[model samples]
Target: MKGVYDIGGIGLTWDLAVQGGRVPPVEFSVDPRVRHSFWALVVGGGSMYMGYVFDQSAIQRICALPTVRQAKLTYALTTVVTSISFVTLSFLGLVAYSYYTVRGCDPFKAGYLKNRNQLVPYFVMEIFHGFPGMSGLFLATIFSAALSSVSSVINGLAANTIEDLLRPAFDRYNTTEKGKIFIAKISVFFFGGLCVSLSFVARTLPGTVVQAAIGFVGACAGPVFGIFLLGASTPWGNIAGAASGLVVSLVLNAWITLGGIMYGRRPVPLPPAPGNFCHVQEVANITGLYLPDPFNNSTGYIDFSTSSPIPVAGIDSGGNPLYNISYMNYALTGWLIAFLVGLAVSLATKHWHEPTRDERLLLPFVRRFWRLNQADELQQAVKLRHSGEHSVEGPQTQKRLISFGNQTSDMI
Candidate 1:
C-alpha cells in the first residue's frame, strides 16, 4: 500500500497517516514498479492544465484576427504546436520511467527523484553519460516542461494584470504606452519573484514535492477558475455573484489545507524524517475502486502492509472530528459550489442584458472578427473615395443626411 500511495501522488498523505499511527512501516523507493505510476500522475495533471491554458489563450487570439484566413492559420499553428509539445512530454516521461524500470532503477523511488536538494548531483552524474547524449536530451525535456509552465503563467498573469488592474487605473490618469509597458514588465518581475520565493517556502512544508506544488496552485487558482467559469458561462452572473464564488472557493481550499484552522482544529504533526511514507487504507476502500494504478492491483485491492498511515482528522479539544473531509476531494467540491452559487444568484437577480461594448472588446478575438466583417459590408455600399462632384465626405454621407431631412418632413 505504501508503494501504491507513492505511485498515486499521495505519498505525503500516506506519510502523515504513518506519523499519526494510522498505518504500518513500509519501504518506499523509486522502484520500477512505481515509477510509471508516479510519472503518469505528474505528467497527466500538468499537461491537462497546461493544455487548457494554451487552448483558451489561442482561442482568444484567433478570435481577434481581422480575417478568416488569419484566424484559421493562427488557430491551426497554435493548436498543433501546443498539442505536439504536450504529447511529446508525455511520451518522454513514459520512456524515462520505462528505461529506469528496465534497468532495475526506480526514478520515482523516495530518494531518486530529482528535487532541488538532489537535482545538482543528479545532473552531475548524468554528465558522465556524454554532454550531448541521452542525458542531455533528458535534461532538455525537463527544462522544456519547466519553461512551458513558467512561460504560460507569466504570460497569463501579465495579460490579466494589465487588462484588469493596471489598465483601469491608467485610464483614469491617461497613461502613455511606455508607462503601461513599464507597469506590465514590473508586474511580471514581481509575480515571478514572488512565486520563486514561495516555492522556497514550500520546500519547508511536510509533503511530497508534487503534493506541495499541487496544493499551492490549487489553493490559489481554485477561486480564479470558479470566477472565470461563472463569468464566461452565465449571462446573469454579476460581479457580486462572482466575488461570492471566489471567496467560497478560497475559504474551502484553505480549510482543507490548514486542517480546519479557521474552525479551531489543531495542526497535524509532521513525520520524523524527510523520506517517511504513509497510506490511507480508508481511502482505498471508500470508493471501492482501488484508488487506480500503480497503487492497487487489477482487482482493486492494495497491499496495506507496505504502506504507512495517513491523518484523517485534526486533533480537537475533546478529540472530536474538526472536519470529516479529504483534501483530494476539495477541488471538485469547490468548483461545484462556486458554479451553483454563481448560477443561482445570477438567475435570481434577473439582471440579464446586453454586455457593454468594452466587455465585448475584452474578448478580443470575437470583436475583431465581427468588426472586420462589418467594415467589409459598409465598404461595398460607399464609394472608394470622394468624387469632386460630391462633398468631401462623399455622396453616401450626403444621401444619409438628405434621407434624414425627408423623414423629418414626413413626420411634420
Candidate 2:
C-alpha cells in the first residue's frame, strides 16, 4: 500500500500527492520575461499547428483512412487527446515544482543535477528509492520507448531512400529482388549510424534539448510547410517561386536560429530554494563544507546563502534584436517569409500565366467556389484523359469523369 501510494505520487502528481497537504499555485515559467507572454505562446502554437498540418506521419495516417468523414473524426479526436495529455503533463510539472518548494530543495542549485534535463530523472529516482526493482523497471520502460521511436524514424528514412531514390536505378540495372533486399539492409545500417553520429553533434549544442530540437525543426520544417500551404492555397506559384522562397527562408531561419543560440541573452531562472529553510547553510557550517565563490575577488569566507543560483554567462548584451527573439518565433517567421516571398516572386514572374485546372490540388474551399470557362473545362478533361492523371483511378476514375461531365452539362 505504501509503495503503491508513493509510486503513484511520483509517477503521476510527482511527489505532491504523497505530501498529502495544500498545494500552491504553480509558477508557469522560471523566466519572468517569458511568463504569460501572449506573443510567445501564440507563435509557439503556430509552429505546432503548422507542424501537424505538414507532418509526414500524420498525413500518412490520415490518408490511410477509408473515408473522408473517418479521417476528419480521427483528426479531431487526436487533437482532443493531445490537448488533454499536454494539460496533464503541465499539471504534473506544477506538482513537481510545488513539491520542491515545500521540501526547500532545488536539485540543480544544490549541484545534484548537472543539466536541466536531469531534473525529471533525479525526481523519479528520489521518490522511487524505497521501492526496490521499480526504478530499474522505470528505466527499462524509458529505454524501450526511446528505442522504438528512434528505430521507427530510422526505418522510415531508409525505406523512403530505397523506394523513391534508388528504385529507378535498380530497375534500370536489372537488380534482383534479393539484391534490393541487401541494399535496403545496408541502407538501414548506414542511416542508423548517421543518426547516432548526429546525436553526438547535438550534445555539443547550447541550451536544453527542447529548445535545440524545436529550433532545428523550425529552421527546416517551417519553410517546407510554407511551400505546401502556398501550393495548396494559391494558383500562381511556380517552380521558380517555390525554389526561391525555400532557399531564402532556409538561409534566413538558419541565420536567426544560429545567431540566437550563439549570441542571445540567457534566460535567468527563478530564485533558488531558500538555503535557510532547506537547512543547507546549517549543514555546511557544521560540516565545514566550503565552495569557492565564483564572483568574489578578495580572499574571504565564502557566502553560501546566495550560491545556489546558476551564474549567467555569454549573454550578448546590446546585440541585434533579431538574434535575441524567442525561439518560438523561428517557425512563424520562417513560414511567413516563405509564403510572402513565394507569392511576390510568383506574381511578378507569372502574372499572365493560367492557373491550375486541377481542382484536387486546391483546398476544398478554393475548389468549391472556383469557376472556369467551358472551353477550359473541356481542355482539362481532355488533358486528364491523355495524361491518365485524374485524382481518382481505374473504374472510379471513369465514374468521376462521367459525374464531372454531368455536372458541367448541368452548369451549362
Return the top candidate by lDDT. Answer: 2
* Candidate 1 residue 372 C-alpha distance from true site, Å: 32
TM-score of each: 0.49, 0.70
* Clash count per candidate: 15, 0
lDDT of 2 by residue, 38-141 (tens): 66556655664676656665666677889999998997887898779667656655565544544445676667778766766666666676679877887898
Global lDDT of each model? 0.50, 0.66
- Per-residue lDDT of candidate 1, residues 302-359 (tens digit): 3333433444432333432424233333344455667677767666665453322232
Model 2 per-residue lDDT at 81: 88
**Candidate 2 Cα outliers beyond 4 Å, as residue runs:** 1-36, 167-180, 276-317, 348-354, 372-407, 410-412
